[model samples]
Target: MKALIVYGTRYASTTEIAAEIGKVLKENGFEVDIKDSRQKDIDVEPYDLIITGSGIKIGSWTKETLKFLEKNKEKLSHKKIALFAVCGATRDDEKQYQEAQEKYLDNIQEKYLTKPPVAMGLFGGVIDPNAKYGIMDKLIMKMVKKDLENKGIDTTKPYDLRDWDEIRSWAMELASK
Candidate 1:
């Protein structure tokens, strides 16, 4: 089987996650191709399975991911599809995590990718001050970090909340199906 994994990332964390997913898929005996959504166009019709993901920014997906879904909705609907989202809300609270999942995944599914995916994943994201950010973004993150800390969540240092084991397990499960 052939699988294609495409992702939209800002600070490169989502790209790393997509790469890991592709690696596990390959290990499970599927031929896999991975691409950044910002790259040149490629047809999705050749792949037997399609997986797409994005890092959430203000409860919205990257424009590239949205465009890809919109442009290929028909072809994707005919293939086995899986979707994932990366966001920092999972690091805070259960209610926040659920809300993020609904806003980032469920709503996106309902609005753009109308075809149901075989599986969907909600993964925690990283927060790094060193990463490139505009003045407003940096200011916002500072406040966010302070708020998290006040809530008894340690945000004094960079946070990488991804669960590698869970990611690999999910990829393996997708391969099996």
Candidate 2:
């Protein structure tokens, strides 16, 4: 079987996650191709499975990911599709996880996709002040970091909030299906 995993990221964390998923799919006997959503003229019709993902910044999907979906929706509707998003909300709160899923995944499915995806994943994203952000973004992240800290969550130096176990488990399940 063949699989294509395409995604967009702001600070490269989503790119890392996409690679891991592709590796798992490969291990499960799939021939996997991973691409950045910003790439041009991608033909998804050749793949048996299509997985797409994005990095969420300030409660929004990366524009490139959205554009990719818009460009490929018709072809993707006929393929086995899965969606994932990396966001900060899925970090520590169960309720926030549900809300983020509804907003980032469910609502996106309703708007851009004709059929529901085979799976939708909402995972925690990293927050790092040292990343390549504009001055305004740096200021905003400072406040966001302070707020999370005040809530008793230790915003560690790197603040890498992802759950690798959950991500790997989700991929394993997808490979099974």
Candidate 3:
């Protein structure tokens, strides 16, 4: 089957995860197309399955991914589709992480509840405090860092909490059906 993997990333962490998913899908004998959500236009009709993802920033999913879904809602409803989100907060609290996923899914579902996507997945994201950030993200990260420090949390180690095996298994299951 043919699949399209589309994503948006601010720090490039989500893009990495999306690419990994594409790789695993290809290894499982699926023809996969990986595209950045910033594309001016997209043709969803060409693919049998569509998987879209984006990085979460400040408790919100990227705008590009949301726009893509809204733009192709009708076409997506007719195809096998899935959604994923990548965020650093996902690693700290499983319940909160899941709530974030549900929030995004709810937004999409509210728009297309009559015809929802086939499935959805949530994945952990990478965090690099030293990475260049805009004024707002910088300030936010600084506060987060302070809070973590007050709680005696280590901030030096960069963590990539994504589960490649889980991603592979989900893609394989979708492709098999």
Candidate 4:
């Protein structure tokens, strides 16, 4: 099978996740192509399977990803789609994880796309203070950091919440279908 993995990310973490997904798909004997949404326009027609993901920012999926979905809705409707979301909310609490799924994944499925993903994942994200950010992002991160501190969560270090084993498991499951 041929698969296309497309991702949208602000700090590159989601892109890394996409690469890992590609690697796992390749290992499973599938032909795969991975693309960064910011760098290129994608045509889903050539692939039998499509996996698209995005990092959440201020309760929004990246604009590029949304546009790609909107533009390619017809093509995607005929293919098998698996969607994943990356956000720090999953690292907080069960309630937050539920909210993140509702906001980031469910909403997109219900309102944005013409086709529903056969499999969906809501995964943890990364937070790195040292990463470059624009003034607005910096301000938002300051507020986020303050909130974490208030909850007794340390903001002094970067947080990586991606679970590679879980990611690979998800990919393997998808590949078997």
Deviating ranges (above 4 Å) for candidate 3: 112-114, 150-153
Residue pairs in candidate 1 whose N, alpha carbon or C atoms collide under 3 angstroms: none
- Per-residue lDDT tens digits for candidate 3, residues 92-155, read 6878776776776666566643466676777777777667789999999888777767867677
Model 2 clash tally, residue pairs = 0
Provide TM-scores for the models.
0.93, 0.94, 0.88, 0.92
Q: TM-score of the candidate numbered 3?
A: 0.88
* lDDT for each residue of candidate 4 in 84-113, tens digit (9 for 90 to 100): 998887645989899999999999888666
lDDT of 4 at 43: 79
> Whole-model lDDT for model 4 versus the true structure?
0.86
Candidate 2, 1-177: lDDT as tens digits: 899999999789999999999988989999999999888888898899999999988778888889989988899889999999998876458898889999899988998899978998888878885566798898898898788789776666667888889999999999987
- Candidate 4 least-lDDT 10 residues: 109-118
Query: Given candidate 1, what's the lDDT at residue 133?
Result: 84
Rank list by TM-score: 2, 1, 4, 3
lDDT of 3 at 171: 69
Residue 68 of model 2 has an lDDT of 86
Clashing pairs in 4: none
Candidate 2 — which residues are off by over 4 angstroms? 152-156
What lDDT is obtained when candidate 3 is compared to the true structure? Answer: 0.79
lDDT of 2 at 77: 86
> Alpha-carbon error at 128 in model 2, in Å?
0.7
lDDT by residue for model 1 (50-89), tens: 9999998877889999999999988887899999999887
List ranges where model 1 is wrong by over 4 Å: 151-156
